[model samples]
Target: MRIGELGNETGVDIETIRHYEKIGLLSVPPREPNGYRNYETSHLERLAFIRHCRALDMPLADVKRLLDFITHPEVDCGEINRLIDAHLHNIRERLHSMQSLEKQLEVLRARCGDSHIVRDCGILSELVAASHKTGVKKD
Candidate 1:
């Protein structure tokens, strides 16, 4: 099938498919006599695998490594396990950072409530003081 048909069948954007091809994630398929690219069943399966990996938030480099493993099924899965564990560690770090950000925002929000004019807005005052490096501690 043509590139458009392959994209439609795989639910991937044409540009992304082309990018994958350009980046060596997907192989370029043979073209017809009319010069139209003819994708095969293998392309469909590979694209589906890539889409699934992307849905899992796996980076392209990791996806490529996984693809390498797929190409060599005889390799032990220990490295794959290590890669997933590292990804989990990174996710945990981000979650901790996000939680800390939430707490900071909550503290900032508590600086002011309704019924105050802009001049007396405690939140804005705190922000301005912080921007100037006034060393004003949060209460």
Candidate 2:
């Protein structure tokens, strides 16, 4: 099939397919007699796998490593398990940080009970007072 047809079937953009080829994620296909690039089922399957990895938010390097593993099915899957575990750890850390941020914002939100003039706003006053105490000018 042609590039456009491959892209349509895979639900990936043509430019992204080209980029994958450029980045060595996807192999370049041979051109037909009419000079159109001819893609095969292997390309479609590989592209689908790539798209699934991307949907999982896996990094490109990790995806490449996973693809390499796929190419060599004899390799032990322990490394793949380790990679996924590491990614989960990172995600948990981020979630904890986000929760902390949410708590901090809740505290800040509680500083203001009602709307007032900008100068009389409790949140603004607290921020200004904190900055003054810290010897930092408010931006």
lDDT of each: 0.94, 0.93
TM-score of every candidate relative to the true structure:
0.86, 0.81
Residue 72 in candidate 1, Cα distance off native in Å: 0.6
Q: Over the stretch 1-139, how does candidate 1's per-residue lDDT look in tens digits?
A: 9999999999999999999999999999999999999999999999999999998889999999999999999989999999999889988999999999999888888999776789999899889988879665688
- Residue 113 in model 1: lDDT: 76
**Cand. 1 Cα-lDDT:** 0.94
What TM-score does prediction 2 earn?
A: 0.81
Tens-place lDDT digits, model 2, residues 96-126:
9999999978888898888888877778888
For all the candidates, what are their Cα RMSDs to the real structure? 4.2, 3.2
- Candidate 1 residue 112 Cα shift, in angstroms, is 2.3
